[model samples]
Target: MIIVNSVEEFGQRYHSAKRWRRCMEAIANLHRLNPGVCHSIGDSLVYRLVDGAAPAAECFTGNRRYVEIHYYLSGSETVAYAPKPGLQRLAPYSDETDRETFSGAVAGRHAASPGQLLIFDNDYAYQLLGSDHLRKMVLMVTIEGATFHNK
Candidate 1:
């Protein structure tokens, strides 16, 4: 997991990621945006805009084929993070949605404000617990390179 505090930092680290570069370009083009699918970079990448209250811990979500970047455009939010080792699954994994919700004791909660990004890898489960209102963009990229297990 990585917490990026600014675009400069995110660029410095993940600029080589083509999908992430494309997503940033699309975000720059949006002057007037709504709450929905903003852009699809390709089959391996997707960018979405979510404006709503974050769900509960029972609704914790994890992905197997993708790593996610949650960029808080405005407002602030917290997310619960835990590894898959002992976390109890709430439902079966959905290939179509690429999400598997689980419930268990979390390692800790993380908070991000505007201009901050939460980067989650494929092996860990992270839940975005929201506030009354939050505006954030999520970039989901297909899994690639070294995983946590290998390191």
Candidate 2:
């Protein structure tokens, strides 16, 4: 898991990285495009604008094929995440959608506010908790050059 507090930090962290830039550009396009509409840039980058009330409780989700990044555009929320080892699978993972659901105790929670960016790898499950005004831009970038083992 990686959390960037500002865009400057993001730039400093991933200086001139093409994949990261592609992800950032996709997010910028989302800001220019219609709300709640999903967009994709090549096979590697998928992004969308999400605007709605957050779930009442944590609804943990994870993906194996992509690294998930969330940039808060408006409002605030709490993000809860935990390692997947002991989590009960609420829904099986789907290759078509590249997502799985889980239920378990979160290891920690972070207060997410505007201009904050959160990045998560496949090893952890996470959920967002917020009020009716929650809005964020989400990007799913394919994990490059990594092999996964099927259990």
Candidate 3:
């Protein structure tokens, strides 16, 4: 787990970081491969959700399609999920497959303040709770695992 004090620090560290480049490249290829993919971008991509604009929704472990990188620009967003050292469950979107990947790290009460960047691997299961009057910008890069791993 890594944390940066400000968005400038995050940009300096990750905008050009090795992983960032690879992630961008992988995402480009992923879009080319899968056109108009809903799994890539969510309904909130590049859009700001102000307080009372939308209710805080529960975030769960997404499927294995593309990686989700959440770069918090401002405000506070709370992430909740099943804690580790427990049964080790990802997320039970359905009853089945709950016990399969039950040993991975689950995201818990994590805060993404302004200038903080949070990267969730394909397996991390969690939720986002933005603070009241909280304003932030997020960039969701859709990177295919195959291309991401190959490079």
Candidate 4:
């Protein structure tokens, strides 16, 4: 996986919409390669996806040339996200309208929150539960071995 010291590096390579998606696919594969790849950004691990009659959860959506980590310094919510499906992969932005469309077929939720870190793949569809007031820090680290050859 690629690792960047700062967001600038992540931004430089992921400046384009297409390239950023590739990063998302790479990270998504990580989960398949190793389920343990999912973990908190910091200490304490107690996050899970739950199903219910809520606002479909909330998630910060963005793309970078690396795996992105979202830390919930405060606030309690559920995160629902899934990889951009099929040709619609060109989607970006975390707007509600976009989320509803993305959430059409996929599903994700946070069953519990016992820490202050949330790490996930890039550009995937996700939602936070409990409330709309979410305060957290986002970290995007470029994965190693990623190439911009075609981009």
Q: Pick the candidate with the highest TM-score.
A: 2
- lDDT (C-alpha, whole model) for all candidates: 0.78, 0.82, 0.46, 0.42
Model 4 lDDT tens row, 1-151: 1223333454565566643544334433432332223333222121222222235333334354445555443455666556655214334543332222233444555532423445565546454445544443344444455444444
Candidate 2, which segments miss by more than 4 Å at Cα? Answer: 146-151
Instruction: Give per-residue CA lDDT, model 2, range 44-133, as digits (tens).
Output: 787888888766664798998999998888888888899988689998889878889999888999988899899999999888766678
**126, model 1: CA deviation in Å?**
1.4
> Higher-TM-score candidate among 2 and 3?
2
**True lDDT of residue 47, candidate 1:** 79
Q: What is the TM-score of each candidate against the true structure?
A: 0.85, 0.87, 0.49, 0.40
- In model 4, where is the ten-residue run with the lowest total lDDT? 41-50
Q: What local lDDT does model 1 show for residue 68?
A: 88
lDDT of 2 at 32: 81
RMSD of 2: 3.3
lDDT of 1 by residue, 1-151 (tens): 6788987788788788776787677567555566785577666677778888765454668888788888888888888888877689999998777789888888888888999989888778887676878888888887765244433
* Pairwise lDDT winner, candidates 2 and 4: 2
Local accuracy of candidate 3 as per-residue lDDT tens digits, 35-118:
223332332222122332324553345424334555454457776655333434445544232212343444457777765656
